[model samples]
Target: MKKTGEKTWQLRLYVAGQTAKSITALANLKKICETHLAGQYEIEVIDLVQNPKLAAGDQILAIPTLVRRLPSPIKKIIGDLSNETRVLVGLDLRQG
Candidate 1:
């Protein structure tokens, strides 16, 4: 359960399957969240391979897409998330 007043960073990662790109994206996401958002975040991984319909909701055009669903003004970053700086900037964690 979540506290009424606490804010949590909600992230959704869209991937097709357990491909190398998907695995890498997930790993990088974990590390980034731990280093930045810490315990104040939640990750919801959506495997399109399991449920292709879920992709439409997020308008996912590619695999390994990370969507920031919280903190308003939803944001998106597409790729394997190999670049920490790019991820951070895309997520609004740092200046572009």
Candidate 2:
């Protein structure tokens, strides 16, 4: 349950270097955050090429994966994030 002033959305995007998919994913994620979550969200982008060891921590199996770490139950979406509806659903902003 979200308490008073504690409903921030925490997101992490894991990618391998700056591939085309990774770049698109970041752009899409930023748009979603700005349009949907806005000030109530935070995004962290991690490049696996620079730090491969970090992937194990989040169990990232894909090159471009979006992980939602906050707002209670965690969720993940794997892909370039071109599908806006799917992204919204993954973030729990819409019915999945």
Q: Largest lDDT belongs to which candidate? A: 1
Instruction: Put down candidate 2 lDDT per residue, 32-66, tens digits, no spaces.
Output: 88998877888889999999999999899987999
Q: Per-residue lDDT tens digits of candidate 1, residues 1-96? A: 557655578999999989999999999999999999987998999999999988888899988999999877899999999999999999999999
Best by TM-score: 1
As a TM-score, model 1 comes out at 0.92
lDDT of 1 at 80: 94
Model 2: how far is 6 from its true place, Å?
A: 8.1
lDDT of 2: 0.90
Alpha-carbon TM-score of each model against the true structure: 0.92, 0.90
Candidate 1 stretches greater than 4 Å from native: 1-7
